[model samples]
Target: MAPPAWTTRPNAKDDLRERARELRRQHRSVPEVAAELGIAKSTAYRWVRDIPLDVDARKALFAREHSSTTGHGQMMAEARWSEYRAERDARQAERVTGAAGSVGGLTQEELVRIGAMMYWCEGAKAKPWNSTRRITFVNSDAGLILVFLAFLRAVGVEQSTIDFRVQIHETADADAAVRWWAAKVGADRTIFRRTSLKRHNPKTVRYNTGADYHGCLIVSVRRSRAIYDMVEGLVIGVVRAAGRPSAPCDPWPQ
Candidate 1:
């Protein structure tokens, strides 16, 4: 025989009330508990409305919710940052392209000024204590050497009057470096002096090595006192002009 309706109905209601209480303990809203239990909202409220929340339980629930939200926010922030970087890089590239277009060719006067500046910084200076006058340019950069050679040519210095030398670590490929520099500066290999070798310490690490490491080149002009004097004057003039209130002439002579 079937059980009485009163007995079964009360049991089902009791189970639903217990589930609602458990949901409240988990810090779920009354509406959410009601929806999950498939019970009437009024019944759900009646079951859990009087329950007081514990501080620790509330904090746990907030943490769970915040974790989900934080992941989404982080992704959105990263996407926006990527877009900003791409736009900035594009603008920089456009500026570089415009600058390249503006520099068509350098005038003789511009080369003279630039050459003097390079010499003043990289070439040996005649100090009051040591007064040896010579147009000696030393650099590791091949491009700078080529510019110096061009400057010398512009000022009517013959190719025969220039001498080349290499200073490098004994551990490096001296012959290979001389060959590379000769090709780079468009000079005869025979003009190069015996490569000066410095003792290399095993404990010291060197960044410059391998195929790309062409050691420093020394380009000395024979009987260059007059040229050296002229370069000194040009450097002094450039410095004085820089100090003046008036804007210096366009560094790039047309």
Candidate 2:
């Protein structure tokens, strides 16, 4: 027993707590600090429970890990492509310099009109009595929210203006899902409103969690013109990026 006591090590919780305190002092995140110290995320959380943090430590951590060097690389790539687009647009504009009086091809006004039409047709909600200035899409698929958000941004809608709400079954993991989506879009949880849907039959097969859940997001446009233009650019830019030709069509084609 004495030999076994000699071989045993003392509890290191105090050491871990001290290290965690130091990391917090240096503005290190719980997850990063945990990873560095070979501890669990929960342990890190517990250690920092009593400590006060000026900013959201968890989010700060996630952004540092996910949006650091990799995010910069992607941004640089996008910037290079944007420059190429500007050059191409200038060349195209030069070609149509003679047709300035007429709205012929690849003009700024034409682009704006095209973008408006595209947003009206695809993104905006249409009703028999009135066309609501909102975009509604159905999905039970996972990760669609992120895709939709990216699309909105591509079309010119600022992330700040976008709102999100989740419609889920009453018994489902609605809270968890909302948290996950919030983290994904880098948006605050307050932006999400959880609604309950009653299921009459309890025996029916349904996806309750993970990627299989059947849920949809209600996306609304507070600024219609801006949203429309953004969407139009997104469509044209995507088509051009794919090396395909896209012509603007009528909003209410006969």
Candidate 3:
């Protein structure tokens, strides 16, 4: 092919075209080869436009360039994902820490009120037909059990008066659970009643397996008729107080 009008020397123009042809054989694009050889892209294209690249060479070139761009995209995506996870974790930590700190400086009166509310929710209540009101508190959380024990202690219920038992799935470690509970409540393991096992159902899949799965503890107060009455009265008082209407708000300006 004839070189551009700017090139008057035939030998130098032939050398340029030869060099451009070698670059194209090595899978370089026309524009890239032209830029490197200090020639116009149009001249480079005209020189090698009819020269077909081998199928293998074309595929290899595409793979090489595609791999580079794909690697860059992967790195960019990974960096963004890491940044998002870090931001989310920091935000969650801040919220959790703030919430934990806000509950600090709780007075005895406040704890008592909170305990009563917890009892109202979780403790056994007296039904109209079955009027056997007892101080039976069942829970899976050790912290809650400890808190309830504290409330009982504050209200003058001795450790000897409280009965302990474990209610767990038949698949769990009942002995270990009972021992753990006894230690937590500052009671003897021998004092704990026999472990209550819920028969395993083959049809159901249970998630409460592993080391963290210590079954629910049943805390029953011995001869707690008076204590039960007090708890019921306290709950009744709270309900009545909550039901009362608040003072009316003043009307807004027209």
Candidate 4:
């Protein structure tokens, strides 16, 4: 005898509901439960949606299933950051060590040459008509300034020849700059002409306070040739010191 059609179809609604309930109780994901039971994920979700579970119960279930995931992700990120930091630290250490090594090798002649260039380029003011030879430098950076004055003493520019030293600067704190330079170089302030003060305006974009301002001293020599020769020699000396062999010639050899 053939079985009844209703029996053969096998009523699945009750079975599906019971399975969904069991899955939710066991803390299995809805998608995982659906896949195991051969049903649509939406259908599995709908089966369990009407059931009430407390927030604490849901939180406990989530913690049990995915506790290791957070730790694993954090460890991966930390490992990557550690590698980057180590590489950065190594490069910085190499630079510091290399700089120290170079400094120990510098000769007295090289030091004097460095002082001369520093004065010419960084300390001195350039006039439009006269080249850097007619330029004037302030005794600002104490170490370099001392070295430069020693070089000047060696070259024999006498006290009388060091005539009419003055400072040309903006009106704000011009006097302070002059005083600072005079004290540093052991020169008489009486020999200094009055500070050349420039007019200031509110609309001026020059926000420079000139606080680090050591105003330049105009060391007017009797013969310009000696000053010019010193400046030219400084350029050639600096190039050689840097290990770049450059042909010695005055850039403006007049």
Best by lDDT: 1
Q: Would you give me the overall lDDT of model 4? A: 0.65
Global lDDT of each candidate: 0.87, 0.63, 0.85, 0.65
* TM-score result, candidate 4: 0.44
The sequence of per-residue lDDT tens digits that candidate 2 reaches over residues 52-170 is 66667656655665575668535745787999999999999987885765654454444545544444454545458875545543343446555555555555667666667766776
Return the lDDT, model 4, position 163: 52
Where is the poorest 10-residue window by lDDT in model 3? 243-252
Give the winner by TM-score. Answer: 3
List runs of model 1 lying over 4 Å from the truth. Answer: 1-97, 248-254
Which TM-score value belongs to model 1?
Answer: 0.62
List ranges where model 3 is wrong by over 4 Å.
1-85, 243-254
Better of 2 and 4 by lDDT: 4
Candidate 3, residues 12-71, lDDT tens digits: the string is: 889999998888988887766887999998999999887777888788766654576568
C-alpha root-mean-square deviation, each candidate: 14.5, 23.1, 12.5, 16.1
Q: Report how far residue 129 has shifted in candidate 1, in Å.
A: 2.7
Candidate 2 Cα misplacement greater than 4 A, ranges: 1-124, 194-200, 207-214, 225-254
User: What TM-score would each prediction reach against the true structure?
Assistant: 0.62, 0.38, 0.63, 0.44
- Candidate 4, residues 1-254: lDDT per residue as tens digits? 99888876857688778988898777666765787888998988888776655788668656744467667435645787899999999999999999878776556566557656765676444568645555345543556656666656555666666554545446567667667767877887777766656566767776446567555555555565666577667777676756644545435435
Lowest lDDT 10-residue stretch of candidate 4? 244-253
